[model samples]
Target: MIEIALGALITLCLLLTGTCLWLLTNQREHARWQVERDARDALRDQRIKELSKRLDAYLTGSVRMGEELQELRRIVAPLPDKLNQMEQRDPSSLSFTQAARLVGMGASVEDLTQSCGLTQAEAELVSKLHQAQRRKS
Candidate 1:
């Protein structure tokens, strides 16, 4: 009977050891899964932060462009009034036609802008167009 009891105690100890090992293995697997989940969450949060910063910059640029457009409109609003005043002063002096004529005659862009009231860009465009026309002819 004593031998049988010793055998039974050994069996119980082995079963307890196996249970403890299995519990430890399960706990370790769960810890690994938790770690992976935390890492993924952190990466996702960092991406969101970066995208938010980019979106804010885009919004700022859009607002700046809108303000610049408003200022350009403000500056251009008086052009019609000025054109009318110039026309009243001298109806026969059409500046754009005069500028184009001067461009065809090989006038400098500065001369077009000063003497004929053309912008430098307008003078350049007229010069280019007349040059192209002359080339085609």
Candidate 2:
């Protein structure tokens, strides 16, 4: 009877030891997994912040471009009227080519051509007129 009781006690001790070791290993693994998950979440948050900053910069640039475009339009708005007045006063005396030349000396040829409907020959004439006028001035 004494030997039998001692063997049962030894077996119970071994089972308890195995259970404790298993529990400790499982706890360590759980901690490692949690650490990995936290790191991934932090990296994702940082990426989101970077993207948000870039989007803000893009929006700011778009707004600045819009303002610059509006300002350019405002600066050029009076030119057509001035050109028309000049033409009205000297229709027979000034040719389209001469007008185009004058416009080219100070303004964009594309803008002048579109506004005044001047042909390429007229644009060249206008450029020549502008040179002559500058010389006189």
Candidate 3:
């Protein structure tokens, strides 16, 4: 009876030790998995913040471009009327404008002087100006 009691006690102790070891290993694995999950989440959050900043920059640039375009529109709105007023104010200047157009069409200085009634110096100046304009274009 004494030997049987001792054997049962030893068997119970071994079972308890095995259970404790298994529980400890499982807990360690759980901790490691939790740490990895947290790291992934942190990396994901950082990436999201970077993307948000880029989006904000794009939005700001778009708004600024829109404002600049609006300003350009306002400045150009009265240009046609102003040009007509200048043409009406000086009817003879129309001859010079036509002379420049002819020069752009590859006309010679003598042609401008004859067709547009420009002086030789005026025709030469118009030809030079249109040639310079063409080169710049």
lDDT of each: 0.88, 0.79, 0.90
On lDDT, the stronger of 1 and 2 is 1
In terms of lDDT, the best-performing candidate is 3
Model 1: worst 10 consecutive residues (lDDT sum): 91-100
Clashing pairs in 1: none
lDDT tens readout by residue for model 3, 5-86? 9999999999999999999999999999999999999999999999999999999999999999999999999998997788
Tens-digit lDDT track of model 1 for 79-118: 9999867867886555676677888788988988788777
Ordered list by TM-score, greatest first = 3, 1, 2
lDDT of 2 by residue, 57-118 (tens): 99999999999999999999999998878878865565475555557558555655666667
What lDDT score is found at residue 118 in candidate 3? 82
Query: Which candidate wins on TM-score?
Result: 3
Name the TM-score of candidate 3. 0.59
TM-score per candidate, chains pooled: 0.57, 0.55, 0.59
Candidate 2 ranges with C-alpha deviation above 4 Å:
1-5, 93-137
